[model samples]
Target: MTSLPMSDYYFRQFEHDGADAPAGRKGRIFSAICQGDAPTRKKLATDMALRPATVSDLVMELIHDGLITESRPAQSLQKGRPEILLTPAPGRLCAVIFHFVSHTMHCAVVDLAGTILFETTEQVQADKIDKQGFIDVLSSLAGKCTAHIPGSAKQCGYALSLPGIVDEPGKRWVYSAYWPKLSDFDLSEVSETLGHDVIVRKNLNCELRARTSRRKSLGTGKTLLIHWGIGIGAAFISNDRELVLTEGFGEIGHCVLDPLSTVSCKCGMIGCMEAEAGLWALATMSQDQSIPINEQKFEDYLQDCTDKSFLKRPLLLMAHTLRNLTLTLMPDEIVLTGPFVQCPETFQRLTERFELIFPEGALVRKGRKPKIVSGRRSKSDELVGAAFDLFRTEIGALCRI
Candidate 1:
């Protein structure tokens, strides 16, 4: 099935009581400090055009609420009195992240500071159960993880990353090639089961791309991430903000790349990007050539390709598929990630082909070119991004207040 447009997927509705509280003077002050390098009441007040008294009151409230922590006094540069610095209190709150794969579910617990304290992976019986069974397992896992958290944090939020079209508006799993029975299921049942105060279910590719966009080390601005796994999915980020969330904007993998090609995608389509570049595609291709290609073999092949010595037909096909995607999207940078990107030779050839196709104008201008780099935090990006989702929500709440 063809994916829906971004405009049609705004199903979920979020309301904040403090969103219209006359822009609390103290809240404004807090926002300025939170957005800056070193938080100072005086500077915050000045930035927000509020009185120092108001800023001080807001600072005290934030400190008392365990949201911000005071640091050592700042060194006086000019002469007068030194000022105290404030920063976000790390680990004050935490979030749980679940990435639903084709045959397994990956889970992690992350702190407000974006640290993954724990993670686990377990194989799932994808073909056996109905909707309720999937929800029960996921909910049970989330409950267990939340209970395992060391402290007595009251607000526990969840983020689920799954394949296929997620109808955020309907809070349902619209479609999945791997989990066909889950397509029409209302996934929110898991949230209700866990009883978490806040729950977010999003496409895994979108969450991954959001994590990549928020990575400070990458220095990425606007970019597209192409994740090749059980399915081919894409995520888009512009100007450091995720524009595709809840909008279904990055279902490029489901886009029909070849109308007449005989290859069929799990989504019941022919010649889709997923059919072309997905993990199953590579595995199928490898098996056809009698190249033993399970998960371990896939990893070994990737290592060989990365070393620049291997160039099998399957790897070449993967490269050509990526090249076509890069040409079509023309994102500032196209990030090839997920398990498929593990193949070194495949990745190199893909990059080589990408350069060959666009050459100079590929992704960037001379000095300002977008660099395609390997994802460093493979396992943690999703969890960190999930934490960031809550962080953003909290920030938005503060803004509204």
Candidate 2:
């Protein structure tokens, strides 16, 4: 750690939107190593367009700060001296990530290199845990994960990957259709109790940011990610490798599909897309039949249902919504996440219906048609995304050391 603790720098960065450019020479080099764009000092100089001496100076400073380590490769084909490779130090500059999925909390201690040092999951009944209970568990988990951070590493801060609307600037969880009881909760003071700054963000944004790294394989064109879970939402990345709509951009769930329908959305709207097609709404429907609201169990129920028509309305609604979005966005690929899309039969039916509605015809041109695919959410991806997001955004502070 430098004169100022990394945790304090993280707090300041979390509160302020700093420059988009990676900080100075030191920051650029560190960012390069973190992104795996440069593994050796020679590569770093070439990539950053900096001289070898400047790169060496910055790399030496990084090594002295314990933010990075240099190691020589075992095999060298045509070299008098072995090439030294640069990698992020495993025990330095770590963060604690809390991912709040439906009825569960997934916590992990992740290093700056996108490695999960430790992780744990806890389940809670929706009716049981209140704001205090949630905070207690979060603080406890923070402590547990903090204990796992190696002594030499500086624990930067805590990141909450929550569901629903997050007042990021305020660090407040404004609302969630599923976790209604915890709505309008204040998160500013959470840092006080945990003894570290806490940054709050919507879960989809974190997942989308992590998934966007695969844009090269997915396509250089636009890639859209739609999550049809407890709440239906979407995230998009453009051809320039920029995330579009940082907050509340692709909130398809709140779009009113019917003005006269009595089905109420937890967002306080009637006939919203989520009211009809979101898993939460489906859970309510299942509860009417005395069925529990577990995602896996709900998928099993959908698979075993006798009357398949029960899914027709929701599927049609989602398909039509996606069809219009496809036409509007004209993305190269649409990645679907959450339970509905995770279930093979449901995903097949939904995509088939989407194809039927927006076939590559005179209206949508052949090349303009987007490929619809299923996306699975891994806990590791979420943790890495959150940790990397922190480091990437405030990399200047990390390099300042």
Candidate 3:
């Protein structure tokens, strides 16, 4: 997930229709604008390595197509003339984002330019919502959201931030212990029934995509993002890659920590890291300690809980798991995201212990240890990421046209 350099124009795949068609450069320009840089004609030409006149022609075409909106920046103190800034138009393009979490589905309508136009959350009893019933619920929800879209906006389609390991190539769910009904479910078959072209992806990967979009620069180089929330969802990134939407991609949650530990993961695996270090592990410990599960102020509770020795073992175990993952993957950066990792001391202790255990002198003695940084977008990174990914897709498609 290396940050795409502005000079790189291959972010999208565009078939050259003919000599009459706009080339890949057209897509490149549009993508850059959609990034919200609002580059002027001169800046766009410089970034894309095109003549100013060529950029002007593409800008005009894009403007004509309602793909971008141009506005003159107010007078600047250092500049001789005002430059027209190009930006993605609100309501011109949109996508429906559906995130399945717990017994609820968090839904939002997001614009291509990164605006959440509408959002709602609905709860369904997991036991009652069977596979067909779940699909029906999602279909009904999608219809409700789409109905609210402005008539002028172009609907790019629907994207799902599913809870399980999504086999995008196979269009099926590999496993989801919490939502067992979706295991081995064929999403493509349901896509037709839902009446929309769908993009199915693992929620972890969606969060990582959204995280990378916010940090367009950090997308550069190899990175491993660990969402240490209610569950541990692991995602990796390389340059110019789709979110890891494959079977067993996010199953790091099933990574067994202690072969003999009594803890059990929701996946029915004994001693899995999810059972040891996931939010459930913390919650279990809290319950055993007679601590109140303050859902409303969990972050504050986490800060207070970690100060005591009761939560140290799980945090330590979590750190060990992350260290194992780091050594295995050897990414440039490992992002500690999700609610559990938000505690500053918890994050600091994890990184400090990881650095001690994973030293070059002790381990490989080759490359540097990956830098650990906290995740941005504390709330709804998964939901926003789902929309951001689709927004980029829409921009790429629009550019190709």
Number of the top TM-score candidate: 2
Name the regions of candidate 2 deviating beyond 4 angstroms. 1-23, 31-51, 73-83, 218-220, 286-290, 362-367
lDDT of 1 by residue, 269-380 (tens): 6777666656566557553453333444655655654333323443445555555555555456667666556755456666776566546764443434346765522555
Candidate RMSDs in order: 7.3, 5.5, 4.9
Question: Against the unseen true structure, what C-alpha lDDT does each candidate score?
Answer: 0.59, 0.73, 0.68
Query: Which stretches of candidate 3 lie above 4 Å from their native place?
Result: 1-22, 32-57, 70-87, 216-220, 239-247, 281-300, 306-312, 376-381
**Model 3 C-alpha lDDT versus the unseen true structure:** 0.68
Q: Ten-residue segment with the worst summed lDDT in candidate 2?
A: 1-10
Model 1 clashes, total count: 8
Estimate the TM-score of every prediction.
0.75, 0.84, 0.79
Model 1's alpha-carbon lDDT is: 0.59
Give one digit per residue, the lDDT tens place, for model 2 in 1-401.
11111222223332233433334557656656755733899988877677899889889988988878888776778558877888866567788999976788878988765678898878886556789998888988887888888889887788998877776667888777767788898998999999987888777766776666644465457878888877788777674544455555677888875677789878777888888877778768753564445666766666666666667888998998888788788888888987777778889999989878877675555557788899887666567666754665545565653
Candidate 1 lDDT score at position 13: 15
Give the Å shift of residue 86 in candidate 1. Answer: 2.7
RMSD of 3: 4.9
**Model 3, residue 22: displacement in angstroms?**
6.0
Give the runs in model 1 whose Cα sits over 4 Å from its true position: 1-28, 35-38, 46-49, 71-85, 118-122, 150-152, 197-200, 203-221, 240-242, 285-297, 304-329, 355-371
